[model samples]
Each structure stands twice: as structure tokens, then as C-alpha cells.
Target: MPVTTELILARHGEAHCNVAGIVGGEATCTGLTDQGHAQVRRLAVRLDQEHTTAPMSALYTSPRRRTVDTAAHLADQLNLETRVEPALRGLDHGEADGRPWTAIKRRFGGRPQQYPHRPIAAGAETWNAFISRCRAVLRRILDKHEGERVLIAAHGETIEASFALFLPLPLDDTELAGQITGHSCLTRWQRHRNTFGHDVWMLAGHNDTNHLRSPMEVIT
Candidate 1:
């Protein structure tokens, strides 16, 4: 029988750069703020409630401190081991690390054409590369746990990049750029056996954050 999997995508809580208007990338490192901790606490509670019956089978996270910390909390609730995976790390901003958004805008005279496609100053990973890395990591996770309930704590950029990979929409680069926010979602994928004995993947959910009651639920 083909196996179906559920992925709970949780964006890491706020970091200092997130509140300081700085563009955070793999190169620029920051820890979670007090509010960030609180946000994750709320997230932990929400996940506990949602999975009270279903139960998560495993917990996974980026090696980044923010994501690791968030996954630790979820792991506590689920009694699962937290696995740190480097492939889940945020995009490499290269030269843009620690640069304020205002400075970036000033350099470009405005917001660049679109994210990923738009170069940040001079050095940064292109959108295609960002998407490819995210795809690779997500695929590895899916293959590792084909039919289990898995939880991933990652960055907003990582989540958005994965969204682009799973959903076939007419989202431009700019729109794709704006999709990531500090939030969490529940997404599932099921493998269906066809008449020819082949398994096909199906879309279950995308960016569902009902746990976030409102904008207030998002802690900066």
C-alpha cells in the first residue's frame, strides 16, 4: 500500500534581525528574542492541541539556532528526537547579511524587481538556487519518512521556497517573495496507487495557519 504523509511546517520564531529590519540569511546569524520564545510556546501549545489524537511521529529542524530551539519545544511535546539537517538552512544571502532593508532599498533606489531573481547588491543566491536547495531537503525528508507524520521547524524563506515547489500557481517572483512570514502551517501529502501499480503524490494543504488567530497572533 502506498503511504500518505503529513508535514507540519513551522517557521522559526522571530530573531533580532527579524525585528531590526535586517535581512537575515545563513551568513548572518541571530538568536530568538523573548517574544520569539513566547511565539514558539504558543505554537507548541497549538500543535499539542491539534495533534492530540493524530500524534506526530518525528521532529526535524534546520541546524540554525532559531529553528533548533523551536523544534526542541515541539519534540518535548511529542516525545520525539529532534534531527538537525543542514539542508533545511535558510538561503545564503552572501553580501546582504546583516544589511538593513532600508539600505538595500536605497541601493536599488527601490525594492528590487523581485526576490530570488533580484540580486542583493552584488552577491546572493539566485531564486532558482534557493528553490532547488529547498526542494532537495524536502525531498530527502519525504523519502526518509514516507508514511509518517513529520514536523519541520525552519525559516520563513525556507517555507516559502518549498511552497513554490509544491504549488503550481502563477506567482511572480515578487509575489513569491512576499509569501513567507513568521507563521506555521499543516500540509499533508498522500501517495495513491494507480491501476498500473504506480504511486502518485497529491497536494493536501498549503500555508494553512488557522492556529494564528489573527495578525495579533504573529509576534514580532
Candidate 2:
């Protein structure tokens, strides 16, 4: 029998790097700001209101501080068991870490890409590596939690990578420029086995945060 899985990927609350307009590599600027905390709270309420019938199965988050902080609010609201999964870590900014996005843009004349896989930045991980890990993480999550509603609190790049994993790889640079997952936004993907028993994945939602129409500053 084939299984169905509902996966929700929520970007972590705004971190210091978000406010400072810097490139936050994996685990850098992991803590949330004051408004960031508020964003999580609002997200929690939204989730509670949403899952009145279609309840969640489990909530997972990256080991990073910001994601952990974001999950904490959700955990409290729903009293759900929250697990820390390292595979959900953010992409590496490499030599660009902690540098302002404006500065990197000026230096690279816009987002530099090594095309097929490599990032133009000297020390950064390849785009190929990032998306590959994203695909692998999805497989791992499915293996353990298939046919369930699962939520993952992670990073913007992780969310983008997840969305991109649905697309064919070795992508053109234009396709590589994916959408931004704003602070505390929710993106969802679903998988179900076909009549032939092959699992097919589909995007149910992306970057949804209308529940947070507040005037607070959000990280893109």
C-alpha cells in the first residue's frame, strides 16, 4: 500500500542577521529578535486555529537556535512533541557569512552562481550540495513519518531548497533564483502513492503568512 505525507516547512523567526541585512550562514545569528518572537506567537495561534480538524502528527525543527525558538512557541500552543533534526540545517553562506547582502551584491554584481552546482563565493557550499541535502532530508522524514501531518521549522534557504527539490536538478541560473521564504512563513508539500505504487510529490502551499498581516518587520 502507498502512503501519503503532508509536510509543512516554516521558516524560522527573524534573526539578527535578518535585521542587520547580513548573510547568515548555517547556525549563524540563530537567535530570534523581539518581533521575531512575536511572529512565532502569531504563527502558533494561526496553527491552532487551522488544525481544528486536520490536526498535525509531529513537529520538527532544526537544531539551530532560531528554529528551536520558533518551534518552542508551536510546541507550547499545541503541546506537540518537537524533535530536532540536524538534516534541516540552513545553507552555508561561506565567505559571505555575516556580510551584508548589499555588500555581496556590489561585489558579485548580483547573486553570483557557479551555474550547475558550485556557488560563486570561494568558501560556500555548492547549490548542488544544498538541494541534494534537501532531497535527502525529505526522504528521511518520509521514511519515519509517512502518512502523517508533519511540521518542520527551519531556515529560508532550507525552505527554498525544499521547494526546488521538487524541480529537476542541474537547473538554469534563472530557475535557481527561487522565491524568498519570509520570516515565519509556511510552505507545504504533499506526497501520495500512485496506482502504480510510485510516490508522487506536490506543492500544497508556499510562503503563506497572511495570518501575520501585522506591521512588524519581517525578514525576507
Q: State every prediction's TM-score relative to the real structure.
A: 0.78, 0.82
Task: Give the per-residue lDDT of model 1 (tens digit) for 150-213.
Answer: 8889777676666666663333556344463544444544566777878766656556666555
Model 2: lDDT to the true structure: 0.77
Winner by lDDT = 2
* Per-residue lDDT of model 2, residues 1-220, tens digit only: 3438888888888888788888776646658998889888888888877888888889988887889889998888877988988778766668887788888767766664435355647787666677778779877886788689888888876777776677644555543456768899999888868888798888778889876895444322
Residue 30, candidate 2: C-alpha displacement in angstroms: 4.4
Best by TM-score: 2
Candidate 1: give the clashing pairs.
Answer: 116-127
Which runs in model 2 stand beyond 4 Å of their true positions?
1-3, 112-116, 169-177, 192-199, 214-220
Candidate 2 structure, TM-score to reference: 0.82
TM-score of 1: 0.78
Worst 10 residues of 1 by lDDT: 211-220
The count of residue-pair clashes in candidate 2 stands at: 0
Whole-structure CA lDDT of model 1: 0.70
